[model samples]
Target: MPTRWELDKASIYSTKAGEKDRTYLDSAFCLTDDVSTPSRHEGRQVAIGKKVLQTLLTQLAGQGSALSRERTALVVATSWSDESYFVTGVSGKTDAPAGFTPGEQVAELAAAFALGGPALSVDTACSSFPYALDMAQALVNSGQADNAIVMALNTVLPPALFLGFS
Candidate 1:
């Protein structure tokens, strides 16, 4: 089985400089109106997608989704390593800024909700989100865990990635 949410190409928290300069290329985002700052790492990280996951988590928990409680484990399907640069884009494929890491941040987010399942960071670039979902579903289907949270988060418009677009 498969489930997914692909955000349409639109501007939710985009900076005018990017759009106007033709340098900003961001994917559709799921964000809270309250959090309205255009993130420098809009496509690779700190994009509106995180807000989308949080919202979905809340809704699922409210509806009693299998992965709502503390017993549920979450496997984060990510592309860039926390050690990768937020401003530098995805790490494995390229070099990012110094001291930028995601492992600690991922753990912190999971801990904030008191999650008990195995917390992991997967770096599959572009495919991170769907992969994460698949991993979560597999865990549930295999009965290894009651529920799973797979988070796919990435930002865009990095200097290196621009070549692909051009």
Candidate 2:
């Protein structure tokens, strides 16, 4: 299946050096809620999630041909929060703590395009976005959708989450 949501362009926005002790700011919007602080995951988590959705929407909108009124596009986003406690589990019952409510964020993004389709969030271990991309292609191949948006976002950090990757 061919990708309907072509990654024609992408960008990463980082905070000024040492702003947060050199921690990865990952997204333009940073999540202020404490991911591991038990009850402080809403603010930061939502901020990061919205920032991601906003970025994707912005990119898609930039694609004059991709944005159309007659074609619907599906959006799928993945995050590593499912494996990190820093985000906690209050955001939603996903495999991740900072995971955004699928319908809420997805719809928020889809609504931006005049021809948006169903929006979904998937937490497939480390391959969430790849799986979602496959699904999106399937949608387009099977005549279910004309376009798709798939993104993988992980901005927060948990010590154990990346113990061996360095």
Instruction: Write the residue-wise lDDT of candidate 2 on 1-166 in tens digits.
Output: 0121121212211244333222334445644544443332443433555566566667867885435435665655555442233445644666544434545545545665454565677767677877888887887888777777666655544433432232
What value does the lDDT take at residue 30 in candidate 1? 49
**TM values, all candidates:** 0.55, 0.50
Cα lDDT of model 1 overall? 0.54
Per-candidate total of colliding backbone pairs: 12, 8
What tens digits encode model 1's per-residue C-alpha lDDT throughout 35-132?
Answer: 56433333324334456556877888788863645567767666665323443443333433343356754675567667776666766777878777
lDDT of 2: 0.52
RMSD of each: 10.2, 12.5
What's the CA error at residue 156 for candidate 2, in Å?
2.8
Model 1: residues >4 Å from true position, as ranges? 1-50, 64-68, 81-100
> Considering summed lDDT, which 10 consecutive residues are worst modelled in model 2?
1-10
